[model samples]
Target: MIPSSLRARFTIIAACAITVALVLAGFMLTLIFDGNIRARAVAEVGDDLRTLAANARIGPDGRLVIDGDLSDPRFRTPYGGYYWQAGRDQQIDLKSRSLLDFTIDWRPQPPTGNDVAIYERPAPEGRRMFVLERRVVVSRGGTPTIARIVVGLDQGELDEARTAFIQFAASSLAALGFALVAALWFATSASLAPLRALRAALMEVHLGRKTSVEGRFPDEVKPLVDDLNALLQARNADLVTARARAGDLAHGLKTPLAVLTSTARQLREAGQAEAAADIEGEVQRMSRHVTRELVRARAGVRAFRRSHPTPIAPVAATLTRALSALPSPRPIAFETRIPAEAAAPMDETDLTEVMGNVVDNARKWARGKVLITATEAAGAIHIAVEDDGPGLPGDALSYEIERGRRLDEQVEGSGFGLAIVKDLVEAYGGDLTLTRSPLGGLKVDIVLP
Candidate 1:
């Protein structure tokens, strides 16, 4: 099966193209070789024909005579892969013994002013020969007589030569094609090296190891790198503006809330208890909303780079130890069973704060033992903090992040409500699910993505 890869695709295309070209070139070479050899054979046989014409003449009795002899020894040997003949009025007057009992296969043509017709014809024993024939005017002893002359050689020799050349060309072109494909592979790897480096730089930026993508890239990739850097800069500027706005909003609202608190206290001292309580309750609610928005406003891009991998084991162990050390009306045993390698994409401080809330809540309500077990699956971290005390019923469970209501006024808190955990978890794109614990207590399941 062909894999879905660029290099594989390129190599396949190159190999196919090279194979097609080599096949075409091989066929073309064969034709060219065959044509060239045939032409050469015709030219060579023409020399023999000219020799036969020059050595012939008509005697005074009107008979053909020969004087000169061919230099090729094959003419003297019987069926020696070469043959020749001379004739007059389509009758044989002289012939080479190499023809044996079988004459050169030919058809006579009428005289046409030194024109020669060369062609291939079959000989004895399934052999083929190229024959060159023409009618020449022979004059000797002051008398002229027209005689037909023919010369030919075996076509098998030209075929053999063509076959040899094709074999050699096929092998040579195969090697050339292989070398070209190999070279193309190396070139492709070299060309894509820049992309791999750019990807690494991008990974570093994504992991928060670098503020922006930086590298010496090729011209084709440099523009993309520049665009990424520009985008990073723009996003950084926007985050700075947002964080500043969040800070300003927090600072601006504190004065009014503080004044309201002061006004509530003044009302209480002046004997207006109901009014004071209402104003204080409103102030507290406003404070919670402001805190939630402040965290949210600083949230958008701030978490992008700060959410480094925080190992759950160490944080969970630390929280369990601290919560266990705190004083409780009844002794509560804290259990921690987190794997060492378990980690989440969260800042250390954020994980500590988030886990601290859940663990402390469990310790506060846990009657005998509190269990904290964390596991990871499906690209998320699941941390469940369970207490063995009386768990909240279905209706009493925390179904909302904020309602300005209290947690049944049964247990005290660190003032950082579950709403804060939910807001923070959601900001980092995690979850907070509250349910009944298996140990007759509440279970807080947090899934951080």
Candidate 2:
């Protein structure tokens, strides 16, 4: 039986795989969003650098200065949160009051060398600064003088915002994973429900309580169920035919045996001992022949029964008991090395008859032992019978097995055993081979579909 927890394992694996993919996708989206936010911040700082450079002036001695307050209300507000510095000839000319009398300590770096550079430095108020710098050439006193503009943005707020976004994304991803696991559990159960129903239906058939399976199965499994049901129907029809044959054979032979018994009794009462003895002897032989024919006929019927799925163990056991009742039974050793529940599409009674006849024949010539064994291979069932008896003559064996031939003409019994085996085996879509046994006797190997 397969484990029930297998569904849970599958669900966990699927959910984990989906969650991992989604989390990676979500992280990539977060990185793209962070990049967009940083791009907008850089653009805003570039605009501020342009406006600050436009307000610069030059003294008569070529000292660069700012002519106005150069302090927008935006600079004083923490919401603006920006720092600016202007330098001419490498000397600070103007700075943001937000720097609070603290000069921006940015190195006068040429912006053309690198598009952007970020660094942490000490601010005017000794606060930590993340500063961005750019160099601008301004026309002062009609001469081009180089002025460097530095812009600083607060790092604490940006760091806090990024951390909050990461926390939110992590929590959302965790929730999505939990939900995915739950959904997977429900989906798996729903998908497998039909298989469970099919299992229960099969179990019912196994118990002999149902003759056919019926259900609305998924498209993938419908064909399997249909084939199984068709096989069951065919088996039931075969069983009906078998029962009819058995009944017909009994009805046909009972009257003749009764007449023979009555005739023998009448001869004895008339004081004709010699005639009575001869009649009785013939009657006994006739009776034996009738019985053997009935057995053979019944075996044919059984072969049809076994064309359905029939377990081998019980059939083998039944044969052993039935064959034990034979008058001249030898030490017939019946060995079955098959699973107790191993089954095939074979009639139990047919299997029994096949084994019984072969074993009985071995017992006739076996010195001490008759062996019967059954096994399965390559989707077929194989039964082999052997004995430690005088083996059949090679030429005689071949001649006897020929169709419609009888070998034991004077053997005071019906010589139809092998013939019947051959017919019945063929009817069941199987083959029977007669060969010399390793035990020094005839070996019969039967292969059945």
Give the poorly placed runs of model 2, Cα more than 4 Å off.
1-3, 59-63, 67-74, 77-81, 101-108, 113-130, 206-209, 230-449
The lDDT, on a scale of 0 to 1, for candidate 2 is 0.70
lDDT for position 412 in model 2: 31
| lDDT (C-alpha, whole model) for all candidates | 0.81, 0.70
Model 1, span 227-257: residue lDDT tens: 9999988988888888888889889999999
| Residue 190 shift from truth in candidate 2, angstroms | 2.9
Q: Tens digit of lDDT per residue, candidate 2, span 1-449?
A: 43458687788679769888878978897898688767776777766765666676667767667566544565775434567777865678777776666676756455674255656667444456577776666675577877777887766546667788888888888888888888888899998888889989976665444667877899998999999889988877876776687678777878887887788789899898788889888877676566556665565555433435677777767766776666664455555566775675556666665566666666676777777777789978787888788887888777766653432342335334676666667767788888898889878898877
TM-score on alpha carbons, each prediction: 0.71, 0.48
**With candidate 1 superimposed using the best TM-score fit, by how many Å does residue 440's alpha carbon deviate from the native?**
9.7
Candidate 1, 121: how far from true, in Å? 3.6
Compute the lDDT for candidate 1: 0.81
Q: Model 2: which residue pairs collide?
A: 102-124, 305-347, 306-346, 306-347, 308-345
Worst 10 residues of 1 by lDDT: 399-408
